[model samples]
Target: MQLIDSRYIMASPEVVWAALLNPEVLKDCVPGCESMTGSAEDGFEAVVAQKVGPVSARFTGLVKLSDLDIGKGLTISGEGKGGPAGYAKGGAKVTLEPIEGGTRLSYEVEANVGGKIAQLGSRIIDSFAKKMADTFFERFQTAVEGPAEAEEGTDETQKKGWFKRLIS
Candidate 1:
């Protein structure tokens, strides 16, 4: 499946770029990431657990950063094994552009799955991929720019992500 999306972050391109290479920020922002280690130059190893449709699995993967343009953009690609559940591999081209007050972070992602997971069908897999991409960017934005302004009359505690709310 393929997905494209973008978000405006209230930070400079440099700051956003730094966060993208930060292992702590990535570990915290990735929806189900349990741990991540390594550097942007050497690539990272990550363990993540997630549930998609009726399948649940823990994935161990290696994520690499390439096509570097300094504070401008890069490509992140990775593949993971989920035992019998399936395997997933994908790549995303991320771009950063300075805007009026911050940076416009955009991404185009393409992913493929195999084994039993692919049996779930494209509709289910597509929706899950979209959600994963959305969640990652949302959490990344929050991590870089801090908590979003609480909506009027909305309880601050209603914010998503248990860890994010706790830290905020």
Candidate 2:
């Protein structure tokens, strides 16, 4: 599958970048994440338990950050095995742009899956993936923006633009 999207975060690029590289922040934001360890410079290992439809699996994975440009952008690639459930490998290209009062983050991702999980069909898998992505971004936004801060005004503008593009 391929995914492309963008979000405006109510923080500076530097702050968002720092949060992105922080293992604790990732562990907190990633759905079903049980543990995350290792360094940002040397690829991290993750254990996550996830359930989709009637299937459940525990995935152990290693994620590497490459083609990094610090606060600007990076490439994230990972592979995981879920025993009888399946195996997945994916990569995403992430870019950060400084906006008026915050940062705009964009991503293009490609993923592939196989084994029992692949038997679930594309629609089910895609829907589940979308939900997971939504949850991940929501948590990430909360982590970077914090609870005490005001909601970002840019979010509405961007949403409207996206809707317009979708309808057009």
Candidate 3:
């Protein structure tokens, strides 16, 4: 599956770029990420547990950052094995552009799966991939910008609605 998306984070490109390279921040942002270690220089080793469709598995993998352009962008790629359930591999091209208030974080992702998990069909897998992407970006935004809060002129209901759109 392939997907493209972007989000405006309420932080400078430098701050978001630093968070992207921090293992602790990434661990918190990634869904199902149980443990993550290493650095931007050596890459990271991670253990993740996730359920896609009816398949549940723990994936031990290595995630690497490459094609660096300093604070501008980079390419992230990783592959993991989930025993007999399946193997998953994907890569994303990420770019950061400074916008009016903060930065525009954009990504193009491509993913593939195999083994028994592939039997679930494209409909299920595609939806799962899209959800994963959305959830990751949402969490990333939150991590970089902190929790959502009502703007000066916004009411409680407006804040609630904005938060709802963020996570959903």
Return the top candidate by lDDT: 1
Q: State the lDDT of candidate 1 residue by residue for 63-145, as single tens digits.
A: 99999999999999999999999999998999999999789999999999998899999999999998988999988888877
Candidate 3 to truth, TM = 0.89
Q: Candidate 2: what lDDT?
A: 0.80
TM-score for candidate 2? 0.85
C-alpha RMSD in Å of predicted model 2 compared with the true structure: 8.0
Pairs with steric clashes in candidate 3: none
lDDT of 2 by residue, 56-166 (tens): 999999989899898999988889899999987887788999999789988887777889888999988887777666677678777776544234774343322221222
Residue 142: error of model 3 in Å? 0.2
C-alpha-based local distance difference test score of model 3: 0.86
**TM-score for all models, in order of appearance:** 0.88, 0.85, 0.89
The pairs that clash in candidate 1 are none
Better of 2 and 3 by TM-score: 3
Better candidate by lDDT, 2 or 3: 3
List the global CA lDDT of all models: 0.88, 0.80, 0.86
